[model samples]
Each structure stands twice: as structure tokens, then as C-alpha cells.
Target: MSTSSGFSFPGRWRATFHQRDLAVFQRVADRHWPGAEPVLPRLSRSANHGLLWFGAAAGMAALGSSARSRRAALRGIASLAVASAAINTVGKGAVRRERPIVDLVPVMRQLKRQPFTTSFPSGHAASAAAFATGVALESKGWGAVVAPVAAAVAASRVYTGVHYPSDVVAGAALGIGAAFALRGVVPTRGQLPPPGRPPADAPALTAGEDLVVVVNRESGSATAAAAVIRDALPLASTVECAPADLPGCLEKAARQGKALGVCGGDGTVNMAAAVAATHGVPLAVFPGGTLNHFAYDLGIETVHDTVTALTSGDAVRVDLGRFRPGPQGPEGADGYFLNAFSLGVYPELVRTRERWAPRIGGWPAGVLAAFEALRGSRPLTAEVQGRERPLWLLFVGNGLFRRVGPAPGRRHNLADGLLDVRAVHGGRTPGLRLLAAAIAGPLTRSPVHAAVRRRKVRLSGLTPGTPYAYDGEVASSGTELTIDKLPEALTVYCPMPA
Candidate 1:
């Protein structure tokens, strides 16, 4: 065999390998089973311009109907984009190998729009590997479903006589590498560190002096939780209040107690956090809500845990999210959230979920609400950072939320002095985009959504009566809204590390 480039030992070996690779391709293509003829041609056509993979991602997001599935689908799509770029631009450009001639391939199996680029690397193979790897990193189940299809797409490239076997192998490696490279650049849900230990200055709970516990009876688990708290801390004063009376009750308790304990869901805890912050008093949290997201993040899971922490004097100082009314709003109107503040379709989804949660259960209700929100909601137009844009949703968390799989719900540090801000950019078909995003996962590569860590965020250009949600409680906001982080704003009791 003769070398096109200057003769070298490695070049000689590569040329020999290419000869063997072509020989193997000839054998495989010439002896193809008749059964594969019908399937391979259609598969090759279906994958044209990557419409098949895009459709798969979108379908997964819509059918999976959960945050995790949506994220996985999005990650897969992003990986495909990266892989395609690398293979088409860098891999193919680096080598000028010609594609196999039509004589070498059976006439019946040839593609109509044969790729014109150098055949040293196959874009289809690269995209297939990258998408499969990316989805697997986000969700194993979704990855499993995608793997066979990806493999089929890669194999179809060779079966259709568009790429040599060696070219497909090289493309697969490039694609996998692209996926990993992209993963490093953009942190995924699994990349975030776990929640940090409690702050050193956190106050310790003491035995039996001016401890007031307020419980919201309206919470799903409040009645049972209140009973447990009463049994656990007999000396502490306990007050049961309706949802409407919670704020006033919390204020009165904050003034009377050296420490305040709240037993309810995120919304109830949010109210108590505001009162606790104002009074400069330590707070104790008992897991009494349906989801108990705040308490779980705080590492306090049960009444037993709260009692133990109170008796042992274990606690931590954490941040609070403060929301102030914007320029066109009422004076002195502000609020605080221990978890997050949400705008756009999320508030409506929450309300819809609440109505069905008791009957269908939380997960099912959430899925149903997601579909409803996607079907019925319109994008909101808001001014963010001085630019007016259409938005589907805006979420601001008290601290940086760690991405776990497809969801950015968990936090690594409660006192990070930063806000976890996320927003979905509105498009011509906002609902369709949202559905596609949910099926594919975060769509960060596309202009569909964005996530960032910041100290503050401002939004304006809202219709006078715009609705928003904070810690699961819905409320109306003015034309503008400002969310700021309050670092180390409140102290709360949590179980000591083992």
C-alpha cells in the first residue's frame, strides 16, 4: 500500500488498518441478510437531519411527564448537538478520506441524500453515542430506552453505505468525548455537591424556656405532627391555627418566645421564617407538611429529630429569600421564603395540583397539573435585567439549588448568600417548547431556558395583577417584583451530624 502523506511508521500502520477496515466493510455489506433490507433503509431515512432523535427526546419529555425524564431528554438533545459539531467540523475536516463507491455498496441499500462530507467520521454514529451517553447520565431508565435506538441509528449508517465501519467507530468515540466535554462545561443535576454542614454560629436549642410552637391545621400532616410535637415537648407552648390566622399567630408567638417552632408545610414554615427573622429569634422546624421539602433540606425529618435537637442544643443559621414589591406596588409590602419563589405557569400548576393532590396523590397530581399548564398557559412578558422578553416561568431559590438528575430542587448550602435563578424563555409555541423541554430535560443549549446563581434579580412589565407563588403559597404581585438574598438571616434547629 502507498501513503498519500509523508511516509512514517504510524502512517504506514494506519494505511494498513484502513485496508483491513474496507475489506471487513465489503464482507459485511456484501453478505447482509435479506430481512435487514426493509428495516435498515427506512431507519436510515427516518434519521435524516436527526429528526428521529429530536422526536425521541420530545416524546420522552411529554410521556415521562416528570422533571427527571424531561431533563434527561434535554441533555440527550444537547449532547447530539455537541457531537454533530465536533464530528462534522473537526473530525471530518482533519481527514479527507473518500466515501465508499456506489459499486462497493448494493444498489438497493444506498441512501438518497448521501452525505457529501469526508467519510472518516460518521455524524450519525457520533450523535447516537453522545445522545445515549448524555441521557444515561441523567436517567438510567430513559437511557436504557434510548440506547437500542441510538445503536440502530449508528448501525444504519453503515448498512445504508454512507459510512465505512471504521469511520462509524471513530465517530462513536468522538461523540462520547463530546458528551463528556459538554458535561464538564455545563454542570448537570448530579454534578452539584451535597448540602454542607450546619454553620458554626448556629444557636443551640435549650430546655423549656419561652419556646412557642405554632402548627397549621390545614396542612396535610399538621394534625398528626402537632400531636407528636406536643408529646415530644410537653413543656413548650403549642398553638394550633387555621391557614388564614397563621401569620398573626406566628407574630404573637415570635414576640412571646425566645425560640419559635413551626410544624407545617413549606408555606407555614415560610410565614414562621419571616416572623423569626423579624424578631431575631431562633426557630425549630418539625416535619409536618405533606412534602416537608424545607425540613428535609434542613436535615430535620421527624418530630423525634426536632425533639432530640432541641434537647441536645443542635441548630444552624441559614439564608432567607426576600421578595420586595417593585416600583408600581404598595409601600412596605414584602415577603420572605425559606424555599423558593415562582412566577408564570408554575403558580397555576401548583393550584391545580393542590385540588387533585388529596385524591390522586402528589406525584400524579403534579403530572396532571404539568400537562394542564402546558395546554392552557400563555407566556408572560417581563423585563429582566433591563430587557423585555416573553417568559414561561421564573424561579428564584433562597440558595443555590443542586441539580439532582433533571431537577434543581436540592441545595448544598442554605446560607450560600446567593439566589438560584431559573427562567424559561418564551418562543412562538411556548407550550410546545415547554412540553419538548420536559421530555428532553433543561434545553440549556437551546434558548428555551436558563439557570444562574445570583445575589438578586428584578422583574418588571407585568400586568398590574400578576400571580406568583412562594413556598407553595400563591399570591398576587404588582407590575414589578424584586428577589434578593438575605444571607444568614435566621437560625434553625437541625439534628447534629453523626
Candidate 2:
């Protein structure tokens, strides 16, 4: 049956699970619940929370009572109401699906109050997200809570068997679209203004250079980054390719001699850079990676905030790290790194965490990776000339690890003639101590993790293998690894020091 005609509750639920893995989500949501019946009630309570929130927001606006304040408040409310109605009505009517309880395995629930119609898309979930997002646009602090609450509300509909997973997802999109459309409801303060002129000196897109955006749709960070780039480069064609397609896209671009802008995580960046370098094209780095060590090294603050700077920033040369594996009965083995090259605990942590990054975000993945590394092994034998005996992990940065920001009197000197090198070989307890120290502040006085400036290095036993990373990509191999810096190889855009 067509989703528009509405399938049996069980059939629709099953289809949604098959198509979008709603069943998998149900398990994820269960982790945060007490297994209460009529999950919609719990969700409805969150919508009510929005109502109270709006009342407070309105009250605050009234206290000030300027034309600006009143206009902003009204716009915010209207955006909320319109988004809510669309999520609850138009979207549901268009894509009719049934609630799980209506046909699926029945969960005993005391039906205190039934929702007022067929349940294809979830009105509660839609309205909650709409209201929450509208509020968040006005106040980020409030949005932090509202966004989570909205997510919970959507999940609750599934738990209560009032809406299929597809319904909630569609409802969310509908509500967000409505909010975006209603953005012009207020004049200037509450609503965004029209785009101003670009910098008078902003360079035109070079002729014959088509724009290609490689995205790992699964990466949440990449989604936002892609949006920003598209908005900034309105005249350029936006091609959204999957992670696997990245190499192909780069190869195609290089064949055509076009400049490609990659909008994804570190792995994506590294892949794009490698392709660009091989083709000898100027590659622009947009920091969408979780750690963004390269971006940090290049001195960009936030992905969204860097558009103007990126569009108008200067292009300068920077070093690249290359790894050449020694002969282990192999004829050809050479890899390039853009950021840092490391082996030992750090590499193991990256490999362990890279697998889980899609499910949990980068930060959470990093934390988990740290936990796993703690449980796994002690330091391996890392040989470096200037360094002591065996080290846990050895890092060689290409000035891309610590770029300067735009703070007054601050500089992110990419041409500093030095690469940041770090070796981690301390015991588990020492490793944990070092992690804590990093959290505290700069490692100028830390002992467990050693930071050194180096130009070249060689390694033997603790070679590149299982727990190893070049840039953000992880791989397993057995060969003698050589690390060297290539100064001023590629050009990238970045804001000048304040």
C-alpha cells in the first residue's frame, strides 16, 4: 500500500523500520526511558513545556515593549505556530501512516486521551521540534534544552505507539521547513536580513573551476558545513557525493582541472587534499572534522562563521607530512598525511573511535575511544632519535595542528618553520593523568605527554599497523615508516592575525 493511503499500523511501522531503521531507533530511545505506556502523554507534556516557555518569552518582550521587542516576540511565536500546524496537519494529511498501537503488537496502555486523528506523521513530535527550534533561534541557551526535548518528544511517539518512525521524521522536516519559511514574519532583529554585498574584493570563481561538495551524509557536522558552503557559493554548482564517491569525484575534478571544495570530516579532508596534491590543484580546506586539528592549525574558529573569511581570505603555502614505508618485501608503499602522523595509543584510540563516529558524534566518540585505549594495551616501542626509549604514540604535525585565530594581537603563523610533534608512551595511569592535564590547559609543564618540534623522524618495531593514523584516516599495516615535512607545498585561505 502507498504511504499516502495509510497502511495498517503494523505494516507502516514495519515499512518505516525497514526503510529508516525505526526499530533500531526504538531500541536507542528505550535506553532513556522508564518504559511507560502512552509515550505520547510524556511527549505532550514537552509541548506544554513549550507553551510555558513562549509565555515567558512574551513576558520578557512585554517588559521592554519596544517596537523591536514586540515584533521579534510576535515573529518568534508565529514561526512556532505555523511550523506546529504544518507538522500536525499538512504533513500528516499528505503522508498518511498509522500508529504502531493501532495494528502492531499491542502494548497495554491506559488511554487517558487519544490524539485527535489518524497518526501518520507525529504532530506532537513536529510541534515540539518547531517550537523548540523557533525558541532556539531566539536564544541559544534555551535551544540547547529545547533541541534535546524535541528529539525526545519524537522518540516518545514511537515508544507510545502513537506514530510510526517515518511519521516523526517527516513531521520534523515539515516543521523545520515551516519555521524557515516564517522567518520573514518579523522585520529585522528577530528575522534575518537580506544578504548584504560580498566584500568588494571577493574573488570571482575562477573560470572553468566547477564546485564539487563531497559529503558523508551520515556525518552530522558535515550536514551543517555543506549548508554553509552552498549558501556562500550560491553561483557554484553543489554536488553532494557520498564518502565512497569522494575519491572518484576528486579524480574526476582533477581530470577536468577544476577546484573542488570538500565538505566533510577529517577523513574527507585528507582524501580531498591527497587528490588535489596529486593533481597539483589549489585545494581549499573547510574544517568539518570533529577534532579539526587541521582547521585549528590553520586558525579557523567555527565552520559556519568562517564563510566571509574563507571567501575573502588569502592563499598561503603550508607544509604536508608524507609517510614512506620501508621495504618489507613490498615494491610500492607510500602514503601522505596532511595533519599529524602517529602510532601507539593515539592511533589505536582513533581506529577504535572512527568505527563508532557515525552513531555517536566526534566528541563522544573521542571520549569512548579514550576509554577503550585505557582498557586495551600499554605503550609500544616507538623509536625516535631525539626522543627517549619506546613511546606509546608518536605525532608529527605539519603546522596544521595549531593555526592562529583572529583574536587581537594573535597570529596563526602557518609558515612558522616548525611542526608540532608529540609522543605518548606513558603507562595507563600516566596516560589518564596526561589526559587530565590536557584538559587543564597548555602542556608547557606536563611530563607524561611530551610535545616537541621536529623536521624528520624514523620508526621500526612500533611501526604503522593496527592502531595507527595519518591525518584523521586510520589503517593497519606492517612496514618501517618514514616521516618528513614538505614546507610550503599547498595554499589555503585563512584570516590574517588581528
Candidate 3:
């Protein structure tokens, strides 16, 4: 038997199941309440162009304002994109099923722009499931809020006489699969390892015997974090320092300890790492900041992980980025960065975000600061390899960072002895080009953005006192600057890969 839409049922048990499922859902949809009849159709229509999901993602990015929320928002949108592609190209093409007829639903609830493609798997349901699952994987609180709306959107397809219950179910499964498949590429919170025997290669150390830990009190959750570290390594000497005193304290501690430990943000870690490097001591990093990017990359998520690594003597050698001012620049000045250094409006953006991060949080503050920087930023002229060029941004990473989706900022091989250098070329409308590059992501290749790998790079032709930032700390630079790699310069504790 075939429906009026020319959807012929195969002589198979699966076909019979699908037919029964559609009939049951059709009957239920026909008796929908008047309130829902009008409202559900409108809601389904609102989701027609993916506007509903996109708006939800934007809202998440704006309101949550943390690394986790931002990641959730990006992952949710990415999942929707993948789910839509799979449902439209593979799921729908594999079957010749047709959409449900309008007669199955109230006339007021029928969607005007009904999908014309085969409907064995509903695209709307797939996108909704994928987005919700992806978001929940990153942040349960936001995912909880999005769950009901995703469910409603999926059910709306059946209510508006566009998809059968079976079609929605298949699409949802496809979407969930897409989300799971993309997990390796997405940045999510690291899971804590179960307590067990330490790896044989772990470094053996007496608890707190020769360890000196410097904690930044200004960092978020510093007090609690310090207490956790103290409990885990009772003999370790813990020093609490104000933000201003962190560098000096770290240097002092580095001189006095067998192993130096740091519990703070990227900036604090950068300083402590320098001190440890200068003193030729291994370092232990604990995540005690708003966004512990370096520590996360190193697989150190908690104080327990640090304690385990310390006791086991598990450590890894990593590279450091060293920046030096030219002869025309500051006198006798050089510094190290573990993550990256940027010369462009990025410094300004960082300063602006720091001013507002306290009130609104990191991600939202970054969003606002980015808009302000893009709107008012001017092109900077620099001499790269002795060629004068107009540039918007110059980024130098200590090592090759992982390209996760559209962002390239996380490094997997910290010991790689190369600098990851990327630049944004100034064009007729450099600001607008920068915005386009941001939206297009790191995957899209254009003349506006260029990247390379090298051991060293030198830039000149900058105005005196131009600002540059390294590992989230912004400072003034001389007329000329040089960046080079310090391969395997630092030893740091990290968990063994499973």
C-alpha cells in the first residue's frame, strides 16, 4: 500500500512498524488542543530557518560568559550543522518516505513551508537533538534549560503534520550520533581519573617535603584551591601572594624548593614557569583560575591530579616562547610565554575584557571587548622580514596548537620546538575583514589570514610604546620585537594519557 504522497510501504517488518507508528501519532495529533494548535504551528514556523537554535546559542554565549558556556554554545551550533547535513543528505536519501499529509493535523496547525525532501528522518528533530545533547555535554545547567525547547521543537514536527513519530525518532538518533562523533574535535571539560596505582614512570617524591607552591590570592577560588593543595601535600610550603607580588614570590620560592608549584591563571603560570625554568626545577600546575587553559591542555584538572603526579613523579618537558625587544626597544628586556603572544588590537581587547570580566564574566566580556576593538581599531604597520606591511594582528604560539573547530589555541605537543605564527593582513577594510575571518573560523583559508611555522620571527616598524600581550599579560613594546622558541626548556607535571 502507498500513501497519497507516493510513499510506498515495503513488504518488511520495519515498514509495518513505521506505518503503525505514523498512524498512532496521526491520531493523537488530530485531537490536539486549540491553544496548542495555533501556538505549535507558530513555534514550528519560527524554527524553519534554524533561527530558533541560532538565537539560543547566541543567548548562551552572551549570558553564561565562561569558557564552558562559550564552548557549549559553539558545540551546540556545530552539532546542529552536522545533524542537518546528515539528515538531509544521508538519512532522507536512504529512504523514499514522504512527509505526513496535512489532513492528519488541524488546518490551523499545518506548516505552510513543509519540507519537500523525503521524511523518514526529520531534519528539525535531528538538529534539535544534536544541539541539546552537545550543549548538555558541555554544561548541564544550560543543557537542562535547552532540553524542553528541543523536545518541543521535535514534537512540533509531528503536531504540524510534517513528520511521523518514527521519522522524528530516526532523526533524533542520527543527531545524537553526530554529536558523539564530533566529540574528539570539540573542547569539553576534562574528566577526572579514578584513583588507582600510579604509572611506573611517575616521579617519586615525599609529600610536600621539597615542594614550594605559590598561590595568587586574586585568582578565583584561590583560598579553596590552596587548602586542597595543602591537604594533598601536607609538607609542601605554600605561599599566598597578591597579584602584584606573585613574580617575586615565585622567584623566591623557586630558589628554595626542589619542585616549584603554581596555582593560578595562565598569566600566573607563565610567571611561575619562567622562575622554575630559570632555576632548572620541575613545576606542578593546579587549575585555580577563571580559565585554566594551560593546565587543561596539560591534563591537570584538579589539585588531586597535581598531587598524584607529584607523588608519582610524572612529568613532561615543554617548550617556552621567549620575546626580546630590539636595540631600539627597552633596555635589557626579555620575557617568556608558555601559551602565545599577540601584537595587535588583541592586547587592547584583553585589557578591555579584564575591566569587565569581574562583572559579566570572561566569555561575555570578551564578546563585548571584541566588538569595541573591531569597531575602533586601526591598522598597524609592521616590518616582517624587512618588508613593511599593514597588519591587523600577529600571533605567535610557543608550539603547534590543536585546531579545534574554528579556533586554534590549544597545543597537544608542548615540547615541539617550533613557533606557530599567524597574521591577519590589513586590507581596504581591515576591521571588517577581521570580523569576517573570525566568523569564518580558522579552517577557512583566505588571503586576509596567513599562518606559518618557524623557529624565530622578528617584527619592526612599530611605534614606540606599542602594546603587545603574552599569555594574557599585556605590556608596552619597543619599536622592534623578536620572538623565538626555547625548546624543552620547562619540565611540568601532567597526568599519564589513558
**Top model by lDDT, which number?**
3
lDDT against the true structure, each candidate: 0.79, 0.57, 0.80
Candidate 2: tens digits of C-alpha lDDT, residues 291-353: 555554555545433454445544456666667762222546566676667777777787777
Candidate 2: C-alpha lDDT: 0.57
Q: Rank the models by lDDT, top first.
A: 3, 1, 2
Can you tell me which runs of candidate 1 are displaced by over 4 Å?
1-194, 197-209, 326-329, 357-364, 428-432, 435-445
Question: Each candidate's TM vs. the true structure?
Answer: 0.59, 0.52, 0.72
Per residue, candidate 1 scores C-alpha lDDT tens digits across 1-498 of 332322122756878877787777778788957688888878878877778889989898767623467768888899999988877668777877778765677888888777777777888889889999889888889999988988888888888887788888988888888888878877665675546755544344454456899999978678887887777777789999999999899999988877898988888898898888889988888877777778877766568888888887777888988888722257777788888898889999999999999899888999999889878888889998778988898878777666544444567789889887778788777676665554444324357877778888888888877889889988888877888977888888787666
Higher-TM-score candidate among 1 and 3?
A: 3
**lDDT of each residue in 52-131, candidate 3, tens digit only:** 99999999976763467777898899888988888777877778886766676767777777678787888888889999
Best by TM-score: 3
Q: What lDDT would candidate 3 get against the real structure?
A: 0.80
Off by over 4 Å in 2: 1-209, 301-313, 326-333, 359-362, 386-388, 400-411, 436-449, 463-466
In candidate 1, position 265 carries an lDDT of: 86
